[model samples]
Target chain A: MLDMPFIRIIEGLNHTLENVIAPEVESTLAKGQLFAVVEILKQISGRFDHKHELIVEDIQVSQQMLTTLIETFTAAAIDIPDEFQANTETIDATAMSGEQLRQQRDRLEIIVSAALDLLNSHRAEIVDAQKVEHTVFMQLGKNLFRNMLLVSQHRFDKISQLDKED
Target chain B: MALADNSRLASYLAEKLGGSELSISKEWQNTEGWSMETFSLDVEYTKGGNKIEQAIILRRQPVSGLLEPYDVSIEYRILSALQASKVIVPETFWYEADPAVLERPFYVMEKVPGDVHFVTQNSDPDYRLIADDDERASLAEDFIDNLVHIHQSDWKSLGLDFLGDPGPGKNSALQQIDYWSDVIERAGVRAKPLVTLAVNWLRTNAPETDQVRLVHGDYRTGNFIYQHSHITSILDWEMTHLGDPHEDLVYVLGALWRSPAPTDWVCHLLSEEDFLSKYEQRSGISVDRDKLNYFQLLLDLKAVGIMATAANAFAQNKTEDLKPAAFGSILDLAYAALAQHLNERLSSC
Candidate 1:
C-alpha cells in the first residue's frame, strides 16, 4: 500500500497542471507540453499499480525479524508484551490483496519499531545486547536494499528549471 | 493574508519606504526553496525627489513545508543579530509580523548580488561547482572562515540568546535528537524500524560538548551565494540555533552535497581533511571523530524528519506544490541509506 495511492498522485498532477499551472503558462509550446502531460497521465491512470511483490517481500522480512526478536527476548527472560506478540502473529500475507498486504507491512513495521525501542530500553538486562541489535540491523539492511530498488532518482535539476521560469 | 499580487506588494512597499511613484519592476517567488516562501522584488521608486531602484528579498512563512510551525521572524531575528558579526549575510531591512500587511509574517532584506551554485550527481566532474582550481580554493577558504566566524561568535553578546542555548555536556546532542524526534512525530508518518534503531543508538551513544556555540543548522555549499570566487552572503538561517559546533561540521561533510566520484570533495570545495583541519585551526576547537560519527547518524535522522514532514505536508493537502509530494515519495531512499549506515556502524560497535 503506497502512502498516497498512485491514482491520487495522477489526479493531483492533472488537477494542478490544468487548474493552477496551465493558466500561468505564457509560451504556447510550454502550454501544449503541460496539457500533453496531463493527457498522458489521464490515459495511464488505471493501467498501473505499485509492485505487489515488493510489499510481500517487505512483509516476509519483517515477519522473520520479529520472530527472531521474540526468540531473543524469550531467551533473555525479558517479558514480551502481549500486544507485540499478537501483532507479530497476525502477519497473514497469503491470499491478501496488495493493499491489504501493504497495510499489514506498515502495521507490522510499526510493531517491530516499538519492539526495537523496547529492546533498547532493556539492553542492560539482555545478554549479548550488541549481538541482538546486530541481528536486527542485518535484517533491516535486507529490507532497505529491496526498498531502495523502488525509489526513483531525484530530478532536482528539472525542478530547478521550473523554479527559474516561475 | 493573501498578498498574492505585485500591486499589493508595491503599495505595501510604498507605505514602508515612504516613497512615491513606486512600482515593482520585476517580481517572482523563488520556487526552488522548499521551506519558506521567498520572493525577489525589484522595485523602482522616488524618495526625497531622487529615483531609487533596489532588489529586495522577501521571505514569508509558508502554509506548510519541510520545516513547519512556520515562523519567518526567527530567521529575521537571527539575521538582524548577525549584522555586526564577521559572518557575511544580507542586510536586514524590516520585519512585518502583523497579518494585515502580507497575510503572514514576512521580512525584507537586501538582495545580495551573486549566484547560488548547485552541484548535482549528474554535474560535470571537472567543473562540478567551481571550475577554476584557484576559484575553488578561494571559495573553500571563505567557506571555512565564515563557518568559523559563525561558531566563534558570542551568542549572548550578539543578542542571539533568544535561540535558547542547549547548555553544556551532552545536552546539545540530546536536544537536537529530541527536536528532530518531535518533528518526526508531528509529521505523523509511518514508523520505519531503521529510524527508531538509529534514534536509540544516538541516544545511547550521544557525546558531550563543553562549549555550546551558534550552529548554522543547514550549512553546506548550496546555501551560500558566491560572486567572483568570493562568498558574498551565507543564506538560510531558518535552522540556526545554539548547539555543539560539531553538528555544523558534520552537516558540512554530509554526502548529499559532495561532488560525484572522481572528485569526492566535501561540499565540492575541499577534502574532508582540509575542512576539519582548517575549522579546527581557525576556531581553536579540537575535532572529535567520535562526535562526528554520532552526529552523522543524527544528520541522517534529521534528513528523514525533513522528508517525512515534506511528505506529510503534501499528504494532508496543506499546499498544492508538488515538490513536497516528490520529496515525500523519496523518503524510502533516505531510509535505505540510513539503514545501511546503521548496519555497518552497529555491527562494528
Candidate 2:
C-alpha cells in the first residue's frame, strides 16, 4: 500500500502545507486551520497500510448480511428477483480497491431495498410478510450502522460552532 | 476570494445607487457556510450631495456549492416579502442575476451586527453570545417569539406564493420528498440504503398539514446572528420555502443544533417544554408530537441529501473548497442519528 500513488500524494500535501501553504497564510486563524489540514493528511498516510484490510472486512460483512437475507426470504417463500439473488453470491474483495468494495456494498444495498419493497407490496395480504419485512429491515439497519462506523473510523468530531474553541 | 474584482462591484453599486462616487472595502469573508459565499464590505458613497457609509454583505452563489444551479432571485423575493412581515431579517438591497458582474448571481443586503455561537459557553470559553444566564433565557424567549411571528405571518399576504404552494393534505410532505429525492439522484452518490429506506418510510407515513406557512428549511443554530444577547436577524433563507411548519420545528430540535450538555434546550436557548409551550401560546397552534417526529426523520434524510450533493460537487471538481468536502465527512454521524430515529419508528410499527 505504501507503493500506492495516493499515499505519495498525501505525503506531498503534507509537505506543501507545512513548508509552503502554512507560511503563506497570514491570519493566525487561517494558519491554524492550514496546520490542521496538515495533521489530517498525516492521519490519512497512517491508514494506507491497512486500507485494503478494512475495506475487505466491510465487504465481507455486507455480503454475509445479504446472503442471510436472501435465504430468509426464500425460506418464507417470498419471491426475490433472480438478478438480486445472483449479485449477493460473492465478490472478489481482496482484489478490489476501497472504492470498488464500496460499489459492491452499494449494489447489495439496492438489492436489499428492492427485496424490502417486494415484501411491503403484499404486506396486507401475505400472512407473514410483515415479519419477513421486519427481519430484512432490521438487518439492513444494522448493516448501515456498521458500514458508517467503518467509514468514519478516523474522522474527528465536528468542530464546535463557528469561532468557538473546541 | 470569491469576489473577483472589487472595482467592478463598486462601479456597479455606484450606478445603482445613483452616486457620484463610491468605494467598497472588504471587511470580512465568512467561510463557514457552504451554499453562499458571504462577503462583508463597508460601502461609502456620495449620493444626493451627501456622503454616506454603511456595512453590507454580498451573498454570491459559487459554481461549486451545496445547492447549485439554483436561482438566487428566489431568496431575494422571499426576503423582500418577509421584510414587510414580522420575521427579523436583513434589509435586502439589490439582486444581480447576471453572472458577468461577479461571475455568478449575487445579492447585497445590510450587514446586521452580530456573531454566531456554535458551542455552549460552559464547553467553550470563547462562547460570546450571552454572558449572563438571564440574558441567555431572554434570548431563548425571543427566539421562539420570532419563530412564532414567522409561522403566524400569511405567506399569501407577503406575496411569497411564487415559491409554489404545495397545496393542502399530504402534498407538502410529498413535494419535499420529491424535491430532495431529485437532489439525491442528481448528487449521484453511492446507493445509501438507509436513506432510501427512510424516504420509503416517510412516504408511507406522510402527514397532512393543518396549515401551510413559510418554513425556514435550515432554521437551526449556527444559522442566526446574535448581538448583545438578542438575535438581530435570522440569516440563511436560501432554503426557505412554503411547507408544513412542523418541518422548521423539527429542524430546530434536531441533534445537530443542540449543545452536548445534558439540558434539553432547543438550540441551547430554551428547554424543549418551554420552547413548545411558548410557541403554542404565542402562535395559537397546538404542538403535534407525531408530526414533529416524522419531520425530524425527514429532515435527517434531507441532511443526507445535502451531504450527497456536496460530495457530488467535490467529486466533479466544481470547487476545491474543503468545506463541501468536509460536509461529506459527517455522513457517519448523520447515519447513526437516522438509524436511531428509524428504530424508534419501527418499534411503534
Q: Best candidate per DockQ, number?
A: 1
Model 2: residues with Cα > 4 Å off, grouped in runs: A1-50, A64-79, A95-100, A128-130, A141-143, A147-166, B120-129
- Tens digits of per-residue lDDT, candidate 2, B152-265, equal 989998998998999999999999988888887787642455666677778778999968888988886677888877888988888888889999888878765565456646
Scored on chain A only, each candidate's TM-score is 0.82, 0.54
Best by TM-score, which number? 1
Over B1-349, each residue of candidate 1 has an lDDT whose tens digit, in order, gives 2246767878889989899889988887776677788889889999999999999999988888888878899999999999989999999999999888778889999999988876566556665667789999999999999999999999999999999988898889899999998998888753677777888888888888898999999999889999999999999998998999888999998888888767889999989998899889999999999888778888888888999898888777787777777788888887876776677678778
lDDT (tens digit, per residue) of candidate 2 on A16-92? 46775677689999999888888888887655543565556555555555676566667667777787667766666
Model 1, range A1-166, lDDT digits (tens) per residue?
1466677778877887898799889999999999999999999988767677777777777877788789888888889778666765545556787668767888888888888888888999888776887887787677688667867778886776744565
* Interface residue Cα RMSD of candidate 2 after superposition: 5.8
Screening candidate 1 with a backbone cut-off below 3 angstroms (N, C-alpha, C), the clashing residue pairs are B1-B103
Cα lDDT for residue B90, model 2? 93
In model 2, residue pairs whose N, Cα or C atoms come closer than 3 Å (at least 3 residues apart or on different chains), thus clashing, are A161-B118
The estimated TM-scores of all candidates read 0.94, 0.85
Worst 10 residues of 2 chain B by lDDT: B120-129
